[model samples]
Target: MHDTDDAHSEQESSAIHEPRLWRDKGWTARVIKNEDGDGWAVEMIRDGSAEPALVGPWTMGRNKVDPKPLDATAHQTLVKTASEVIRRHEQQLHAQLNKQCSIETESGSLTVRLVVTPDEFEPFGTLTAVDPFGDVIATVKVPPDFKLTRTRAERWAADGFGRIQ
Candidate 1:
């Protein structure tokens, strides 16, 4: 009755969609012809990104004309390597966005930090100073591309923690 109709609908829906070429561990692997050289390359793209997270050389078959077909083991390896690439990229970005510098101030050793918050409309940054005891002394909004250096940190602290325009 109604159950049979529902089952038929589900089967039709499944049949209408084409199977994915390659999917593993939240990533998709695609092999493309190398433009620069006479070989092939593989690209690993994360689930939601149009750009590939990682692209590298792929093995050639014995005929030396075509790329070897992707298999389960190759997909797993590509996924692992792509995940690592994404992880490293994130870590590098985090380090660049958040910087810390130490300077000797009259009061004591002060820690200067520059934290950047990226936004689509307007990116913002903050320059902060903390005492040796981890107490925030001052925080000022700065340009998102502010660079934290020892000399700049000392200057900011010596200027009474005012805006460094």
Candidate 2:
């Protein structure tokens, strides 16, 4: 009987430190009152990131005046959705930052790569070409806003890989 009580007390103590507004598991889900109107919103934040990865409206209670109270099932569902949001955001960012395409040069087929560096204040990218033997043929700095597309890359290769104008 004493052991059972001790285990229960231990679980209760651990729960005390849990955040009321947030839950963390390499990411966090936080509930907040919606700013625009009557609903609620949940914000998903990844660890070490300053911004929320996702934010969406929450459900309303039967009364229609207040948000449905968050419970274990709702919290679990929110966490799963939030996790996917972060995963998709990461994939999109990766795709934007690193792009590669192949072009047929007079010499041979060359690989073109566009890698972007995004920063808070300034953004920039590099366009690079590699020969069949893995030798870097040309490298150019491009504006961060540069978009890498199949047509644009092909045009660059056909134009002798010069600075994009």
Candidate 3:
């Protein structure tokens, strides 16, 4: 006979398709009360995540007071939307932490890249200059808020790649 704990674990791991809840394909769709209004809302949460990736208004049922029952099609749509939200958020964060520019120097053209490390205690940025042949000419540690523009890269190159004030 299976133990009670094992049975509970098995139930949790299996797919659930209830009217207000649907869990499958590593995502869960749940209908919840809208705190901001009188209507109902649906939230999509990825498995193992603590918070929902997407939440929006849910359609009303025929009676007009209750929310529409969750279906396979609705769950799939929610998963797609929630996945897109996470992807876009990651892209935005990457853009914020990494920057690149090209500048012409006396020696040759160099590509300057600034990548910021988001440390909790000591956030910092690394400024790197690479030649056209992909050789790193110079690298320096800078403050996380350092802006990397073309003009700034040219000035850094002109300053002998020393510490920036």
Candidate 4:
């Protein structure tokens, strides 16, 4: 009886959680708008997963008009919805957080910051602005660039540019 109960609990637990595999499968998470553009859609990708699963778009609920912007709550909901979709289509995935690089580069006399995130959907990598100085810039999606070297980082700082890369 104990074994049966334990097994039941395991099943119930599995029903709710999915391992993050998008990172390993090279799939990236993207939020798209529904046909109406008033809702959101979550997409999962990989070299080979079952048919594309649709993780219903989050709507503005009852407003029947402009959809709300995705915030932390929306983001968490999307992750759960999308993870469930992937679980139904494939085995547990082993996704990894994208590796990141904060690089400093110079553009003339000014300082520039570059950040990159590597993921499956973006098999190449991403680039973005970290900062010119003194503040956190917008978090953005970027492709990773291995070309960013240490010399470039130091040179950039000396050149008067700082990077969040």
Candidate 5:
């Protein structure tokens, strides 16, 4: 037998389309009063996220006092823009937390990578050395702010992958 509770929950969470609010396709867009000025603003929040993914100015309607009502095309555009904003934020975060460099040492050529773990109390980074065959030779924990430049990597390799001071 089908679960009535599940069906009721689905109905409760279903799409909602109103003049100033829209909820569909895993996103919710709501028109709000602009905190900075007299005009209005809109905020798009992804499903299950506590904060809005994108917020920006909203246009006024023909009356000039009421904010423009959201439509299908506007919702789609807002979804695209919010998704792009989230994508760019993720890319920038990954770039900031990960770094890589290649260096030729006396032993051989190796690729070094620094992966940072952002812990609340004690953040740290892991330095890993990979051989040409894609095998990890060594890994050492270092400060989260460790700089993994080519010269630094070469020096680390020269030191036989010892713990950096």
Candidate 6:
């Protein structure tokens, strides 16, 4: 869905020569090539529900006249270049939202059922457990990006049960 207008704006925003990839730490990335000029472009990905934040042209080599062609090395390099951008953005976003919650109890880890009801009046998540008795044991509001990993699930299972705080 991107066109020339978007490209111009994205490049203008990041107009300085970033010699080191890790110098900027406020963006995430996807390495790409500008089809028009056959040059490399790094699409800066940002944290949250928003789409790609920025996109810009990258230098080719020492000459600077010919842009670097997008290949596996270039792609990986750009990804490495933007790693800190993604990380710092994620940290800032997490700090602002404070989006983490867990419940420990004595029985076994109950599944967290995040009930996202947009009632206009009560705009919140009803994070309850998917237990057999169908009782909503706990509730909290967390960012949508939060996830329950398999390893954590295994740990919860190992404990055999308890309400987490």
lDDT of 2 by residue, 19-73 (tens): 3354533556666889887788878776678998788887777988666665556
lDDT tens readout by residue for model 6, 1-165: 479778767756764333333212334454456766776666755434266545677666667655544454554566565566667886885554332234444664456554443445654443345554666554555334444444443454454424333
For each of the candidates, the C-alpha root-mean-square deviation to the true structure, in angstroms, is 5.9, 6.8, 4.1, 17.1, 2.6, 12.7
Single out the weakest 10-residue window by summed lDDT for candidate 2: 15-24
Residue-level error in angstroms, candidate 1, position 116: 1.7
What are the TM-scores, per candidate, against the unseen true structure?
0.80, 0.64, 0.89, 0.27, 0.90, 0.30
Where in model 5 is the C-alpha error above 4 Å? 1-13
Candidate 4's TM-score? 0.27
Show where candidate 4 strays beyond 4 Å. Answer: 1-33, 36-53, 61-63, 92-165
Query: Which model scores highest in TM-score?
Result: 5
Global lDDT of model 6: 0.50
How many pairs collide in each candidate, listed in order?
0, 0, 0, 15, 0, 20
lDDT of each: 0.84, 0.77, 0.94, 0.45, 0.94, 0.50
lDDT for position 83 in model 5:
100
Clashing pairs for predicted structure model 3, backbone only: none
Per-residue C-alpha lDDT of model 1 across residues 1-165, encoded as one tens digit per residue: 699899767655543111224665466787888878889988888868999999899888788887887777888888889889999999999998999989998888989999999999999899999989999999999998888899998988888999978
Q: Report the backbone clash tally of model 2.
A: 0
TM-score of 1: 0.80
Off by over 4 Å in 1: 1-20
Write candidate 4's Cα lDDT for 17-126 as tens digits: 22222222223344456766546555544425554454556455356654444444444555566667767644423223233245534532222234334456765433
In angstroms, the error of model 4 at 67 is 1.1
User: Which residue pairs overlap in candidate 5's backbone?
Assistant: none
**1-165: candidate 3 lDDT, tens digit per residue:** 569788667667888999999998788999999989899999999989999999999999999999999999999989999999999999999999999999999998999999999999999999999999999999999999999999999999999999876
- Looking at model 6, residue 84 earns an lDDT score of 62
Q: How far is candidate 5 from the true structure (C-alpha RMSD, Å)?
A: 2.6
lDDT of 4 at 152: 52
